[model samples]
Target: MANTPSAKKAARKIERRTEVNRSRRSRVRTFLRKLEDALAAGDATQAQAAFQAAQPELMRAVTKGVIHKNTASRKVSRLAARVRKLSA
Candidate 1:
């Protein structure tokens, strides 16, 4: 129901942005899942590697505005703690 040309253009832009954001979010989730699986498997080395991989992806999502800074930091912190515990 976008009557104005500008409104239509804006709707299209939003659609494209939504798709990109969804893709980014999904990618981040996939990385997180990998980390989770590694953790659940109780393999310290694999969990550490997955944590190293996921930390950057989480920060990248934050920089891209797909996630909030504190949210990413908190996730990183919690996951890092779990990783450390596993290593210990």
Candidate 2:
């Protein structure tokens, strides 16, 4: 509806923010997927490197409010554990 001027402005702002958030989330997921693919391919060194690359992106997603802190932490933990298993 957004009949009020303020409401219309807010709606526009929300649309812009949604796109930005979606892009950030998508970028983070791309990093995670790359790490997962490296792990699945059984390349320990590549997986380790991919995890290192993904860690900061995931943390940045949390800082930017695109993801929750705990969720990001859990993902990083699980990925690190998998990378460790690969190393062993």
Score candidate 2 by lDDT.
Answer: 0.96
lDDT of 2 by residue, 20-46 (tens): 999999999999999999999999999
Candidate 2 matches the true fold with a TM-score of 0.98
Q: What TM-score against the true fold does each predicted structure earn?
A: 0.99, 0.98
Q: Pick the candidate with the highest lDDT.
A: 1
> Candidate 2: minimum summed lDDT over ten consecutive residues — where?
73-82
Regions of model 2 farther than 4 Å from truth: none
lDDT of 1 by residue, 22-46 (tens): 9999999999999999999999999
Go through the candidates in order and give the clash count of each. Answer: 0, 0
Which pairs, if any, clash in model 2?
none
lDDT of each: 0.98, 0.96
